[model samples]
Target: EADIYQTPRYLVIGTGKKITLECSQTMGHDKMYWYQQDPGMELHLIHYSYGVNSTEKGDLSSESTVSRIRTEHFPLTLESARPSHTSQYLCASSDNPLEQYFGPGTRLTVT
Candidate 1:
């Protein structure tokens, strides 16, 4: 099993509501990432962090933001979500040469 975890595997909310997607890892990896994906679609990198105090936006554009204060924790937050934001948020981490391991994901919907 992968070491990462994401909360509220599914969520439905109204527009303009603040929401947070939790992500954590137990592998003590310094690299963490957040990706957005539609059902059965390819993953798009939304956010990533190299280590504590080092957060960078990914190649994809996203309204959500992430933070990496602790090596094992990286959380994504949306100050106000919209229907367009509806998608699956996946969390992943890598130690060295190994490929990233993914979390189950949070399926968020804003109506």
Candidate 2:
């Protein structure tokens, strides 16, 4: 039952607030992914890492950033939150690209 976990499942903050979405996995997967989704919309890849200290920006452009300092942790940060940044952020990990384990997801709201 190894799984990915996200903290602060729901968040509400004012514009210009700085926040970090925490994500971690117990399965020790080598590949990690971050995706952003709006309600009723498709998920967009924002960032990914192949291994520790190896990171890359994803297909969809994002203002947020991520770091892969450890095998189990992948956190996304928004320096200054904005209304346009309000969305659901998902964290996923997998040994292979075809199969990914996703976290519960962090729903963010910026006023």
Candidate 2 residue lDDT tens string, 1-111: 448899989999999999999999999899999999999999999999999999999999999999999999999999999999999999999997578888999999999
TM-score of each: 0.97, 0.96
Give the poorly placed runs of model 1, Cα more than 4 Å off: none
* Candidate 2, residue 71: how far the Cα is off, in Å: 0.4
Model 2 / residue 65 / CA error / Å: 0.7
* Candidate 2 local Cα displacement, residue 41, angstroms: 0.7
- lDDT (Cα atoms) of all candidates against the true structure: 0.94, 0.94
